[model samples]
Target chain A: MNARRLAEEIFVPHRLVMIAVAIGLLVWAGMAMRWHWIPRYYDLALQGLWRTIWLLGLSCLFGFMLAVPLGLAQAAGPRILAAPARAFCTVIRGTPILLQLWLIYYGIGSLFPQFPWIRESELWPYLRQAWPYALLALTLSFAGYEGEVMRGAFKSVPGGQLEAARSMGMGRFAIFRRIWFPQALQRALPTLGGETVLQLKATPLVATITVIDIYAVSSRVRQDTFIIYEPLLLLALIYLVIAGALALAFKLLEQRFNRGMVG
Target chain B: MLDWLYALWPGLETSVGLLSLQPPGWGGNLLRGAVASLQIALGAFALGLVIGTFGALGKLHGGPVTRDLLSVYTVVVRAVPELILILILYYAGTDLLNQALQAMGRRPVEISGVVAGIAVLGIVQGAYATEVLRGAIQSVPRGQLEAARAYGMGSVQVLRRVTFPAMLPLALPGLSNLWLIATKDTALLAIVGFSELTLETRQAAGSTRAYFTFFLAAGAIYLTMTLVSARLFNWIEARYRRGQVRQ
Candidate 1:
C-alpha cells in the first residue's frame, strides 16, 4: 500500500475504536443510573429536554414575529418609530439575558398580583407561572438582538433595487413584500442562525427560575447522583448535536437562497 | 386609565423603590455589585484579547493540526451553552486538580469562583475573538505584509509593525461587541455564586422580597456601563480611522 493509504488505515481504526469506547462508556453510565435510580434520572432528562425544546421553539417563533415589525421600523421611515425601537434594541442587547429573565420572573412577577385588572384577568394564571415569564424574557431578548440584525440586513438590500421597484409602479409596501423582505431575510439567515443558537443557549437561564428545562434537570440529576461531570457532559453533547443540526440546516438554506445569485 | 397605569407600576414598594430614598444601603450594594461586574469583565476582556490574538495567529499561520484543534475549540465553545460550560469547568477543574494532587501526594487546591469565572469567560470569549481577529487579519492587505517581509523584517516584527496596527481598525467593531458580550457573560458567573451584579441583585431581591427594586437598579447600572463603553469604543474606532478616507 502507498504511504498515505497506510497512514490513513492506521489512524482511522484508532479513531473508530476511540469513538466506540466513548459510546460504550456513555451507555454504561446511563444503564448504571437506570438500574440504580429506577429510570428516574433518564425520565427527568427526557422531560427536561422536551421542555427546553418547546421553550426555545415558542420564544424563537414569537420573537421572530415581534422582530419583523420592530426591525422594519428600525430601517423604515420616521425617526419617531426608529428612535424608540433603537432604544429598545440597545437596552435589551446591552444587559445580560439572565438578568432580564430574573427581572421578568422575580421582578415583574411579584408586581403582577398587585394590579386588580391583571390579577382578575384570565391571562393571569399563565402569567403567574415561571414559564410565561421565562417565555416573555426570552421572546423580548430574541426580538431585540434579531431586530437589530434584521435592521442591518434591511439596510444592506441595495437602494438601487428599491428605486427600480418604485419606478415599476409598485406601492411601497408591495415593493417591501416583493423585493425588500426576501432579500434582507436571505442575507440575514446566517446571523439569524447564530442568534437562534444563542436563543437555545439562553433557554437554560429559565432553569434558574425553576422552569425545569434541560439544564435544571441535569443539575437535579447531578445533585442526586453526586456525578457532576457526566450529566453536564451529556448536556453539552445534546446541545452540540442540536447546534450542529442547526448549522447544517442553515447552510442548506443559505445555499438554496443563493442558488441563482451571482457569486 | 392613568390610575390603572400607575397601579401597574408596583406602587413605590421596597423592590421597585430604590430611587425613593427609603432603603438605606440597598443602592450602594447594587452599585458595588456593578463595580465587581465591571472588574470581572475587564479582566476577562484582557484575557480574551490575548487568547484571541494567539488563537487567530495560530489559525492563520500554524499547521493543519493546530488549525483543526482551534476550529474544534471554536465550534464546541460556540455551540454549547455558557452556563453548562461554566458549571462543568468549575466543578471538573477542581475535581481534576484534587485528583492530581492526591496522585502527587500534595495538598489539594481549591479554585476560587473569581478565577474560575474569569478563566471560563476568557475561554469562551477567545473562541469568538479568534474568528473576529482571524477575519481582521485576513482583511489586512497581503501586499503590506509582503513589503514588510521584503524589507528584511522578521516574522514577529512584521506582525507587530504591520499586521497588528492594520487589523485594529477592522477588528474594533467585532472586538467591542465581544467586550459587551464579555460584560454580559459575567452575569453567568453569578450562577456559580460569584458576587457580581446579578447575584447581588438576586440576594437583595430575595432578602427584601423587593425583586423589582434591586434588579431595576442592576439593569440601569448595566445599561449605563454599556452606553459608556459604547461611546468609548466608538471614539477609539474614530481615532483608528482618522487618517483613512471614508468610503
Candidate 2:
C-alpha cells in the first residue's frame, strides 16, 4: 500500500509553505477586500441562495423521477415508445440549457398572452411568472442527462435475477418493482450524485430568466457598486462551499446505501 | 390553391419571411454567430490542450508545491459553475492587465472579445483537461516505461516513444468530450455579451417578435454542430483504437 507514500507526498515542507501562503492570501482578502456591501445585500443574498437551493432540489427530484420512465422506455419498451424518448433525450442534451431557457421564457412566454383562456385562467399568475419556465427548463435538462445514465443502469441489472423473480410466480410489475428496479437504482446511485452536482452547477442559468438566484445577487452587487473583483471572488468562494457541501451530502447518501461497504 | 393553404395558417408566411436569408431576415446574423462560436471553440480547445499538457506533466513530475498549486487551480475551477467563472475571469483578467499596464507607465489596451473569450474558456477547459490527461498518463503501463529506460532511452525519449503513444488511445475519449463541451460552453460566453449564437438568436427573436421561429432555427444549428462533432470524434477514436484489443 502506497498510503504512507501518499501521505508523504501530500505532507512535505513544500506543501506546508504553500498552505501558509494560501492562508496569508485568505487573511489579506478578508481584511482588505470590500466588506461594506454585505449588510445592504445580505438579505437579498440569503433569498437568492434559498431560491437557488429550491431550483436545484426541485428540478433534480422531478427530473430523476421523469428519467426512470424515460430510461425504461429506452431500455425495454417497444419501438414506438423508444423512438420518441430517444429523440427527446438527444434534442435536450444536444443544445445549451441557456438556449432552452430563452426559448421557453422569451418564446413560449410571449405566446401565452395572445390566448384569452391562458390570461383568464386561475393558474395564470404563476404561469405568468418566470420561475415556472426556469423550473421546466432545468427539470427537462436534468432529465435528459439522467435518462441516458439510467438507461445504462437499467440494462446492467442482471437478467437472471429478473428471470428468477418470474420463476417465483411474481407478476411482471412485481418482478420489476422487487427485483429489477432496486438493483438498477443501486447501480445508478453513484453516477447520480455527480450528476446532481452538475445539476447544482446548472441552477445559475435560471438567473438569466430573471429568477433571482445567488449568482444573480452577485451580479447585482457588481453592477450596483461598480466594484468587480470583490463580489466575484466572494461568489466563487460561496459556490465552492456549496459545491463541497453538495458533494458531502451525496457521499453520505451513498454511504447510507453502501452499508459501510466501499470500493 | 397555395393562397388557401397560406390563409389557413397566416403565421406561416410571417415566420418564413423572418427566417429567410435575405436582407430583412436575421439569418445572416445567426450564421455569423455560429461561425464565431466555432472559431472560439477551436481556439479555446487548442489553448486548453496546450495548458493541459503542462498541467498533467507538472502534476505527475513536479514538486509538492507545484502539485498543491495545480490541485488548487483544478479544484477551484471545477467547483464554480462555468457562467460565474467566465464572468470573474473576463472582468478580473482585463482589470488586472490594465493595472499592470498602468504600473509600467504604458497605455491601457482593450482586450478583444474573441481573444478574451478564448483565454477564459481555455483556462476553464484546461482544469478539466488536466484531470483527464493525468488519468490517461497514469493508465499507461509502467513496465513499458521501464523497458524504454532499459533501452537507454532518456525520459524525454521514453515519453515520446512509449508514453504518449500509449496514452493517446486512452485519452481520446475524454479529449473528445472536452471538445464537445468547449463547443457548447461557447454559448455561455453569450451571457457575458459575446456575439455568439445564443445572443444572435435572442436579437433575431427580439427584433422580429418571431421568437419561436428564430430560436428553433438556432437550436437546429447547435444540434447540427453536436451531431457532426459526435460523428467526427467517433471516427477519430476508432482510428486511434486500431489494432488494440477490444475491451
Candidate 3:
C-alpha cells in the first residue's frame, strides 16, 4: 500500500472516533480541574505512581527469580519432580490471580493463626501486610506464566548445540552457564518483556486489596472530589505512556537479539 | 484422626442441610449466582465474537489504516489492566454518560451492572479475539478466494460461504479461550456489586465468617464451569475437524 493509504488505514474512522471521544473527555476533565470541580492532588498522584513502579519492579524481580529455576526443572527434571511442578504451573495458570490473592490474604491468615512459628517470626509482620499478599500473588502468577515461556524457549534451543558442548568435554554446569542460559535468555526476552508489561498493568489490581496504587489513588480522588472521569483519564494516560514506552524498549531489545539471525 | 474422619463422614449428612434451599443456606443462592455469572459471560462472549469478527476483518482487508486502528485498539485494551477497565466502565461510564446527557438537556442515564460488566469484558475479550480472527482469516487460502471469484461469487457471497466457514474451524480454539477468559472475568464483576457467584460467595463468607468454606465452594464452582465448558469446546473442535486430515 502507498504511504497515504497506509496512513489512512491506520487512522481508520472507528479508531479516530474513539480517540476524538477520549480527547473530548480529557478536555472536559481539564475544564473540571480549572473550575475546581476536580481537586488537584499532585502529591497523592506522585506517591501513587511511585507505588505502582515499586510494585511492578519488586514483583517482576521476585517472579522472574522464582520462574527461572522452576522453568528449568519443568523442562529438564525427572518425572517425579516435573509432575508436581507441572501441576503447580497448570493450577496457577488456570485460576484467576485475583481469586488466588484473596484466598492467600484472607484464607491463610484466618486459617493458620495458631501456627506458632508463623506468628512468632519476623516474616509474620510482612506476611500480615496486604502489600506482601499482593506481591506474593503477583509473583506466583507471573512465575507460572514466565516459567512456561522459559520452558518453551529452553526447548527451542537446538539439540545439536548442547551435544556439541558436551562433545567438547565441558562440564554440564559449565555448558549450561555458557551456552544454554544465554541462548535461552535471548530467546525468552520477547515473551518475558511482554509479561513484564502485563505485570505493570496487573499491579493496579493491588489497589483492590487496599495497597494504594495509582488506580486506588485515582479512585480516592474521584470519591473525594466527585469528579468522575478526570482522575481515571489521567491515570489511563499515564498507564498508556508507560506501556507504550515498554513496548518500544522491548521491540528494540528484540531487534538487537535478532540482529544476526535474520540476515 | 481416624475417629474424626468417621464422624466427618456422617457429618457430611449435614452437608445437604448446608446446601438447603432457603435463606442462610447456600444451595439456592449459589445456584442463582452461578446462573447470573453464566449470563454475564454469555453476554460478554457474544458481544466479543461480534466485535472480534468485524475487527479482524477490518484488520485483514481494510488496508494500513484499518490495521493500525486495530493494532492500537488491541494494544490499549490488552495493556490496560482488566480490573481498572471494570472499575472505569462500571463507575465512570454511568457518571460520564449521565452528565453528558444532563449537559445536553436530556434524560440522565443509568448504566446497569450487567451492561457495564458485558461492555468491559467484551472489549477486553475483543482485543484477543481480533488477533485470533485476523490470523484465522489470513490463514484461509488465497486460491480458494480466487476460485470463488472465478465461479462468479460476489464478495458478500464469498465471505458468507467460503471465507467465514473456512475461518470458523481455525477460529474456534481461540474463541474458546476468549470464552473461558470472559467466564473467569465475571468474577471481577463482583466488585461492582453484581450478584454473581463470586459476590455471593463473598457475602456468604462475610456473614458466616467461614471464609475457607465459602471460598472453597466458589473455587469449586469456577473449576466445574471451566471443566464443563472445556469439554464442550473439545467436542465442538472434534466435530469441526472430522472431515479434515493432517497433510
TM-score of chain A of each: 0.87, 0.93, 0.84
Q: Candidate 1 — which pairs collide?
A: B15-B213
User: What ordering of candidates by TM-score runs from best to worst?
Assistant: 2, 1, 3
Error of 3 at B163 (Å): 1.9
Interface RMSD values, listed in order for every candidate: 1.9, 1.1, 3.0
Compute DockQ for each candidate against the true complex: 0.65, 0.79, 0.41
Q: What is each candidate's fraction of native interface contacts (fnat)?
A: 0.89, 0.83, 0.36
Q: Alpha-carbon error at B198 in model 3, in Å?
A: 1.9
Error of 1 at A169 (Å): 1.8
- Winner on DockQ between 1 and 2 is 2
Looking at candidate 1, what is the lDDT of residue B169?
93
lDDT of 2 by residue, A1-263 (tens): 58989887768788778778889999999898888999999999999999999999999999999999999999999999999999999999889889999999998899899999999999899998999999999999999999998899999988898989989999989988898888788888888987887788888888888999999999899899987888888888888898899889888877776684457
Best by DockQ: 2
Which candidate number maximizes lDDT?
A: 2
Winning model by TM-score = 2
lDDT for every model?
0.87, 0.90, 0.81
Residue clash pairs of candidate 3? A9-B64, A9-B65, A9-B66, A10-B64, A10-B65
